[model samples]
Target: MNRNKLILLTAVLLLLAGGGWFLHDSGFFQAVRSLEALRAYIAGFAPYSHLLFFLVQFLSVVFAPIPSNIVAAAGGVLFGTLPGFLITFTAVASASLVTFSLARVLGREFAGRIVSKKLSEKYQGVLRTKAPVFLTLAFLFPFFPDDILCILAGLTSLSFRSFALIVLLARPWGLLFASALGGSTLGLSPWVMVPIALVGLALFLLGMKYGNQVEETVLRRLKERRSGDTE
Candidate 1:
């Protein structure tokens, strides 16, 4: 890369490293495991709690494994549903853009290192295909690895604008739902929550069983359609 691009890449890597270390040292990851703990930890930031929460949310996406939904729920409990959703939506969308841009700048070889050889190989088709249909579905669904896909998308022929549109359209429902759950705006008592929980569990089980098949089906269909158009 040119000097400027190399410098930008270095800066991004350093920021991610520093941010990862800070989150670990601050016990942000541990705190996010529990709703009360996360709420209290963010609350400890006090006058600047929202800002801290935003940082935590942003880092969670870029760093991976921190569970953005749990953090969003904590924001809901701490800041209420609307504020929580807004904060999470902004942080996550920004982080997604950052990862996408990073991969685009760094190319497939570097992205393979970041996401791992196996994952890169597994999703390599994503790089070759320009269709956003599968991407949209993956982002919207609960079972897909949405964060990694954000990085993988950068290696595709998709324009930044197309990817941004997908992120904006497909990413909000889950965050909003999680925030509302934490905010208790649903006002779901045991009677309601019990059935909802059972249904959710059922869906989760079903997703686990067939999610990959569904993804493959979508991709296969898209490829067939593209081939037909070419023919």
Candidate 2:
């Protein structure tokens, strides 16, 4: 879609999310709260609980209000440690896909308006070119707000294929972080999780370094495309 339509779509979604919040607060969407409840509600479906756990986890990530740590622990309880970690990765990957798509479809123009021109210009190139690497690091690294950064990525000119592939590669590391620290029902060590975090951090910095260069290329390509379109 063109920029104008995409912006309009973003506006609509924002409004809808606002309305959803209003309804949630007003008790109209009370069931959603129950769904978000940190209970072991997956017991009945013991055979299918693993799949169900994955779905719950994916949705939790998709929705901003639901805390991922809660879902991670739920996975540990429902699916055991190793299985829980695996399931959590699958769910997170799926949720990442949803987040990536929403940004692609509705985030492009809206993202531009939200951030500073300098930051946008500096970052847009990486988004348009090597979005996957940026996304991978963005997913693995915990400090930054992944939600906003993801929406920012969507507003740029990234191809979906690269986004999906990168997300697939990146999210497992994040799950490793989640699993080793908070998600472990079996009580994994801080030292172990620490090494995992160090690896994730290293990868994140690498992604950022490359992302800066890619951003420059993206800007050049965008400028050339605009120049061509004008001609």
Candidate 3:
């Protein structure tokens, strides 16, 4: 990495480390594990509860492994569905933009350091092709690491505008669904929920099993199509 990238990477590392330590010490991580606890914590912010929730969601995405979904669900439980979805969506979308921009500025070398080398190589095709179709699918599906992909997308030829459009369009559905679940507006009975939960679990397992293959397949097809177009 060059001097600029080096400096930025160091700053990022420090921020992540310090922030992680603070969150851990504050019991933020533990509190977020349970919806009720998370709700109580955010509620402690009182007049600033929404703001606190938004900040937590944003930081969760930037920091990773913080389970943004849980934060979104907590927003629903605290602020109700529409408000929660709005807050969660806005925070996450903003964070996505920040991560994408950070990766773009720091370049591939920086990305390789933060993300695994194997994973970086696996998705490098994203940089070569105009494949918003794949990006949309990745963002929409829970199978993919959406936060990491945001950073990867920054390495692509995509302009911030196009990337923002994709984030806005494809990202909301999942957050909305999560917020709705927490809002308890679905009103499904135990009989309905049990089967739904079972099906969701099965799908999650299948996605984990085949997600890489699916990603490779899509990237390969997009590459081929791009090659054909060039020819």
Candidate 4:
């Protein structure tokens, strides 16, 4: 890397370290077990509570403790649907971008250290066909290991613009639903919520069943396109 890029990398690593320290020191992970306790703890921060909440959500995306949905839900309980979704969406998108950029700059070898050999191979195979689509699907569904996939995406040839667009658009839907369910004003009744929940569950199950088939189809199409180009 050039001098400027190296300096930027150093700065980001420092920020990640500092964020991790604050998360551990603040007992935010422990507080995640109870939304009421989490909200109350943030309330104690008074004026800085919103900013702190955003930071914790950002850190969770990188650190992988406490699901993003839970954080979005807490945001809803504290700030209502629109503001909560905005905060969670921005924080998550930012964190995902940072992780992806780091992986891109650091290279696949660095990402390999973060995930297991089998999973790393799996991600590499996925990237061989399409990064943006795979990333969008991973982020859209709750069942996927999105945090790890974010890191793996960095190793692909995806442009920052494409990755950023996918993260912004594809990621927010699930979190928005989660936040709405927790929002004081927007929280749906059990009768309404249960069906939405069921649909999400069904999608998750289908993803688990057919994800590999979809990947293989994409890969085969890519190969066909390459063959046609050579012809």
Candidate 5:
């Protein structure tokens, strides 16, 4: 590993250790018993709570297995809409860039360890087309395997700038929507929340069913456009 990556890895390790200490014997479950409880806990940290929230969001993406929506929702309850969305967006976007960079710098060998051979093979053809549009769409949707895609992106010909730009542009809406719901102080009746929940569920299922096809078709169109221009 290069000096920069080595330093980054060390920093990540230290952060993980610190987080472990925080969670150790702490009433993490009790905190989750209610939104108010969680909010109060975060507030107790005062001015630094935002920074702590930022770290959790960052770690969520870096760890990949951690579900970010829960933390993001908590941000909304704790900080309200605009601030919560901004915090989640910044953390997720920065984490995406970091994960992508790690994969790119570490090369295919490291990426292979992160992503399975079967999953890589499945998406291999789509990625080979080298379309940024598809990547942006992938990141935008909740059902897509975004973390896996980030690792896969590092193995592609895409530049870091383009990747970062796509991440920034595509990642916010879903998170924003979730955070907004959580932050809304207006006690929404089940009638309202249920329909909203249903819509989100429908969108998620649709993304799962059609996301690959949509990505492939977009890539094919882009490839055709490039070939025509060259011709």
Candidate 6:
């Protein structure tokens, strides 16, 4: 049993290592060696490349710090509203799922190293909650680092079925928010970008803090109730 667990763990590590190497080999890493260069390169593609753009954005989300919002906006600018929206949404979902599962198979310790200390700790209470709705809230919040959170959430007690349902529920708003970023670039008011960005971020923080707190409180109360009944 121990040997099996070790083999599984090794396989997971090798998978992540493979992704890292693939990104490096594909020039995904080298392109972003300079953020300005990456921006210039992506911006230049705004006129004629949709599929390539989507691939870059997807890989960036999975492998680097090239933020999702930028990719979404670029999608809109490149593909023009509808197509960009659809393509960017699909890429984000795919990238998110890939990263989430990678993190899940990799385990909490590996996840913590890659993600933030604060983020991983907060996810623990949710893990203990063991409710589908709790996961939905976790995914719904934009501030939660959706991809990383999904990976961490997998480390929890939630089943694969629950995890997937929460992801589906969370998709529309996230997709819309990102698509808006990309699609918004086409319109007259790039300045309108400010409020949209703020609102999305605000909801993310609000939901993560409040939702997690409420979940923790409910768990505490339930434990008390159970203990009281025992006494």
Q: Which candidate leads in TM-score?
A: 1
Model 6 ranges off by over 4 Å: 1-39, 43-52, 56-66, 100-106, 109-113, 116-118, 187-231
- Model 4 scores a C-alpha lDDT of 0.78
| lDDT per residue as tens, model 6, 101-146 | 6556666655665677886675565455544655565455543455
Better of 2 and 6 by lDDT: 6
Model 3: lDDT to the true structure: 0.81
TM-score of each: 0.87, 0.53, 0.81, 0.77, 0.71, 0.62
Colliding residue pairs in candidate 6: 73-182
| Candidate 4 displacement at residue 215 in angstroms | 10
Q: Which candidate, 2 or 4, would have the higher TM-score against the true structure?
A: 4
lDDT of 2 by residue, 95-132 (tens): 66666676666554544544557666655665565555
Candidate 3 vs candidate 4: which has greater lDDT? 3
What global local distance difference test value does model 6 have? 0.62
Q: How does candidate 2 score on lDDT?
A: 0.59
lDDT of each: 0.82, 0.59, 0.81, 0.78, 0.74, 0.62
- Quick one: best lDDT, which candidate? 1
Candidate 4 structure, TM-score to reference: 0.77
Reference-based TM-score, model 3: 0.81
TM-score preference between candidates 2 and 3, better one: 3
Sort every candidate by TM-score, greatest first. 1, 3, 4, 5, 6, 2
